[model samples]
Target chain A: MKLTIIGVGLIGGSIALKLREKHFVDYIYGVDYSEQHLREAKELEIIDEASPLENAVKNSDLIIVAIPVDSAKKNLESVLALINDQQTVMDVGSTKSGIVQAANLHKNRNRFVAFHPMWGTENSGPKSAISDSFTGRAGVICDKEDSAPDALKMVEQVAEHLEMNLLYMDAESHDVHTAYISHISHITSYALANTVLEKEREEDTIFQLASSGFSSTVRLAKSHPEMWVPIFRQNKENVLDVLNEHITQLRKFKSALEKDNYEYLEELIRNANKIRGILK
Target chain B: MKLTIIGVGLIGGSIALKLREKHFVDYIYGVDYSEQHLREAKELEIIDEASPLENAVKNSDLIIVAIPVDSAKKNLESVLALINDQQTVMDVGSTKSGIVQAANLHKNRNRFVAFHPMWGTENSGPKSAISDSFTGRAGVICDKEDSAPDALKMVEQVAEHLEMNLLYMDAESHDVHTAYISHISHITSYALANTVLEKEREEDTIFQLASSGFSSTVRLAKSHPEMWVPIFRQNKENVLDVLNEHITQLRKFKSALEKDNYEYLEELIRNANKIRGILK
Candidate 1:
């Protein structure tokens, strides 16, 4: 199969590397608005060639939209305008509702399958791409029934080849779940980083005392703002709902600590410990 | 050197294993109120023998108090009563203020050097101990000037054997810096884990959508609460201050998203991105 991955940065470039390594694709083409990224992707061997978006879309058997969420909607709309019944279109954006709604009215909407592979690192760009990036991670396919059977099967085949577990949900449900599990984590990390950086003016102290726990909690703060700001904006309502609840939880902990309610604080931590079951 | 480790759990047991493997100690003695942990520590070969606290302290040349922060104070107080000028004593607690303050007026104060290694994992107990855990991590030694020269030299030798960087700071400074960097991260993680676990009731959805970002952000939540609760209690004021600032930052982000202020949100994230520099 010939695959054309749009916005060949971290996610797209990683997928290209994996597909080529697994012998799942004969050739990989890349499309990027940034000429620098396109050149970097080629230099990194993430794609065999770089071409215009239209040229890549028209020639490839599979087209992957792996840009930021808002840009993904625009690109998906354009792909929907040009795609035929035979070529499969898929997106690996964090937000699903906007992209799904944007492509809903297209005549070739059946050719598009919305997917979110639950795997990423704090780094980005073509330089950060690694082979086998999505192995053993969950690949969520939203509203699989809306896509053509061949399109769905082709995406599932790629997922299986990459050793991913396939999960299905509606677009709205996908957005809601991601807001709680994934999106909120980024916001909290960014906020926590800002909190420490703002209040702890003594940068030397932060560097000196930073333990493994602090490093783990603040790891997500290093994520690219360009990638996450649009995600929070696109999924505004769900993100807001969870953000409010998170703040409320923090306030409760603060008050409990202030009142020296050790028992209540212990119970709260015990409840949080339940996450161990779900994580592993 | 004969070494005795009080509280034969994660930190204590790991130290014993590393010292034993390196042949730095002739015999390693374990002392814990919990008989089960002592047995487990012996079974895991973290310690050569299990004995009563006083017996272990008397027989060993070096005594390492690695108990919970709350228990650390009383344990140090008792150990100070029994310790002589020849027996050097040290602690591996998270917070330093309480322990240092409690041991200040003791006759054997010069023999007790307060230290906390800036290394740990989310797991706990004897089973969680790793043989080479402290290598390459910073080991903060508080109020080294107060410790006798021989005692400080002995503790520095142990840090050298483990290949840990030894940093010296006063007790109050250590507690404040740790609260800003280490303690706040655990609180943020626990609150984040609870926020998601509470909002996303469906375990499957959380399991499917959880990316490396979410897992890394909440990784500290898997930490043992019995070990953490006392640390929080010991560092209550500073933790609360950082917690308040963290909540304020999150609220700023929440309002930004609520009003769709993408520019402000982007700038906030850009500021958070500066942490990458310090962390790396």
Candidate 2:
């Protein structure tokens, strides 16, 4: 199949590379607002050619909208407007509710599948893309009933080619779950980074003394604001709910320390240790 | 040299294994409150023999107190009281000020060197120990001026054999710096894990959707309370200070999300990106 990858950056570029490796797509046309990214995508062989959106959508059998959530919503509408009934348009966005809702009113809504692949690194752009990045990660198809069988099947096949475990959920639930599991992590990391930056003036100390634990906990702080601001903005209410709970939990630790309640502090850490069983 | 490692758990077992690998110690005596741990250490070949505290200390030239901060404070004093001028004692504790102060009142205070190896994993026990865990990490010697020159030199040689970069700082400063760089990371991670566990009752949803970023941020939550609670207790004031700053930072994100202040949110994230330069 001829694939058109819109916003050919990390996720889009990765999908293109993986699909091509699996022989799932014969050609990939890269479309992006950034000319440099498009050029890089082509030069890196992440895509076969760089083409205008209208031209790429006209020639391709599938179009994947892989951009920031805010951009993906409008881009999905535009891509859907240009595609025929047989040409499927799917999005790999972090926030699904807004984009899915945006596509609901479109004329070719049935041709669009709302999907999210739960895998990412702190890096961005085509150069950071890896063909096997999504292997064994969850590829969520939100509100699958909203899409036609053919459109959903094609996206499922694409997820299979990327070596992902397929999951189905409603868009709203996906947003809520992601707010707790994914979005809050980024917010905490960013805040933790800011906390250290503000309190620890000596950068050399942080460089020399940072253990793997500190590095792991703050790693996501390196993620770009361009991608994250929209995620927090789009999932504001859910993110805020989780963020409020997170602050409350942190305050509990602060209170425990202030009161010298070692028992309570130990209780809290022991509770957190329950995650070991879940994650491992 | 003969060496005795008090508390034959992760840090102690790891140190014994590495020092043995580097031929720093020809004979190892594993001493711990738990007989099972001593037996495991012997069986794992992390130590050559399991001995009582007095017997181990009398026979060994170097003794490492690798217990929790609270226990290490007492253990250091006891081991110092047992050692002579030729026998040196060192500790590998997360917090420094309390333990260093504990040793200060002892008659053999000058024989004890306060040290911290800046590395750890969430796992615990002799089984969790790895010989090369401290390689390329910082080995901090706190209040080195208070230690006898020969004692300090012996611990420095141990750090060298472990392949660690050596840094010298006072105990007070080490506690404050660690509260920012290390302790706060553990507290944040534990609080984050609690936040997810409290908010997302559906464990399967979390398991399915948790990405590498989420896992990384919460990984330290798995750290044993036996190890972390005393670190927090000893560095309570500094940890509380950093924790307050961290919560304040998190609240800023909350306010920005609540007020739809995307610009401020973007600014917070961009500032956090500064840590990338410091860490990488």
lDDT of each: 0.90, 0.93
Docking tier of model 1: it is: high
Q: How many angstroms is residue A101 displaced in model 1 relative to the true structure, after the best TM-score fit?
A: 0.2
lDDT of 2 by residue, A138-248 (tens): 999999999999999999999999999999999999999999989999999999999999999999999999988999999999999989998988899999999999999
Candidate with top TM-score is 2
Task: Compute each candidate's TM-score over C-alphas.
Answer: 0.98, 0.99
Query: Which tens-of-lDDT digit does each residue in B23-71 have in candidate 2?
Result: 9999999999898998899899999999999999999999999999998
Identify the runs in model 2 with alpha carbons over 4 angstroms from their true place: none
The two-chain DockQ for each candidate, comma-separated, is: 0.84, 0.92
Report lDDT (Cα) of residue B241, candidate 2: 93
Worst 10 residues of 1 chain A by lDDT: A74-83
How would you class the docking of model 2?
high
